[model samples]
Target: MSSSESQDETHLTPSALGTKAHWDSLYALELTNHSSNPSDIGTVWFSDSDCESRIYQYLTSDDLSLSPTTTFLDVGTGNGHLLFSLLEDGDFEGDGMVGVDYSEGSVELAKNIAEQTPNAEGVKFIRLDIIKSSTELDFFGSRIAEEGGFDVILDKGTFDAISLSDEMLDDGSGRRIYEVYPEKVAKWLKPEGGIMLITSCNWTEDELVKKMTSSNSGLEKMGRVKYPEFTFGGKKGSTVCTVAFRRKA
Candidate 1:
């Protein structure tokens, strides 16, 4: 592909939401809000689309058969709500759930919420940048390290936020960080039967699948979560989409 076509294929205009500073500030404010009112856990991204409920259903459905013992990792786990919901509502064990984010404020906010949430004592919140240090899965602790990798990995809005960034990798590839995200994170999924589900509003279903299943990503599309469709200019699409992928053996 030509340079212009390559740029068009990979680029998304940078936005404030794409920066660490933005999340740090927002989570700090959210932390304050939680201190004042424990019920205020913070924003639930894509809640209008019922994203969390659909994801829970997909995981618990007969097709996946993910049990309570199944290990989970939530990328960019803001407020740790998704894991908490899975634990509380879906009866997934808290001990097998872990949430990671780069922002300290996000980690702190999640930890605080976990303390207040029932049966959440086992859920862990860690501060780590996946794109920069995704290779360091050992830091995720003994169970995950010994088990090889998590059974289910989730990315809700994290990839979309990453795609909005203009930051380039330091490897001299001249590619944005988001371009390398799939490969970076895919390694954390078990080579056998592990699944990663991602929800995005910025990209269509086809675009999300292409990014995850790119030549270097070592992942393949397994399934998708259906959403209400709308027709605009004779084209049918949804405001948001969720797709599942499994690491290629």
Candidate 2:
């Protein structure tokens, strides 16, 4: 963890937006340059479990609504690599795909990558911070709610990064992201939607399930657990955890 900046916990909640410097510094470095295999972002992270789980969700599930006519959003998208990977692997089409990030550099890098692939043309990267500019959710949620909802919403680490700052979660900024973001995500989902969250923090699948489950709810009615839809155990035994959540029917 790099200790360079301090956060105003009260004002900058996970829902709150990030600052300019906050994102610029993050995008200053080229992500592909650091990874051993720039092509394989997941492997370069040196993790396997979470990446595999996420891949399964995209490849096997309708989470991204890739019905040759689906449309969706990628919050806190870095270089738009995840969406890029989807275009390559899923071979699925959509009305469009939009990626938003606080870092202008990252947004542009994603755009540059999109140019290399034809299917990814609709994939536009927006240089906006989610913490500051999630208001669109209100307009979008209603739209999805009325229009059969989005098939999927995928988030790999937007919430995780928010956890790294000062006290809010670490202290009194409030609760764990695993606890909070899920609800916000639920609100964004299109009723029968799905959310695939990949994380590298200390929380386990069971813990995350419980957190997402109706809080204060009992054991007999534990949130239904979905067995790992996809598993990838690479050279690394245990790495990150990818928990997939389906909007309850």
Best by TM-score: 1
Off by over 4 Å in 2: 1-23, 31-54, 61-66, 138-149, 167-179, 214-237
Please give each candidate's TM-score. Answer: 0.95, 0.63
Q: For each candidate in turn, give its C-alpha RMSD to the true structure in angstroms.
A: 1.9, 8.5
Residue lDDT tens for model 2, 84-148: 66676555563356677767777766776666665887666767645434454544445454655
Name the 10 consecutive residues with the lowest summed lDDT in model 1.
2-11
| Candidate 2 TM-score to native | 0.63
Give the alpha carbon lDDT tens digit for every residue of 1-249 in model 1: 632244436567899989999999999999999999999989999999999988988988999988778999999999899898888775588998999999999999999989988899999899889888846568888888998999999999999999988898887767788887888888888889999999999988888888788647799999999888999999999999999999988
Evaluate all candidate structures by whole-model CA lDDT and list the values in order.
0.88, 0.52
The Cα error of candidate 1 at residue 1, in Å, is: 9.2
Segments of candidate 1 deviating more than 4 angstroms: 1-8
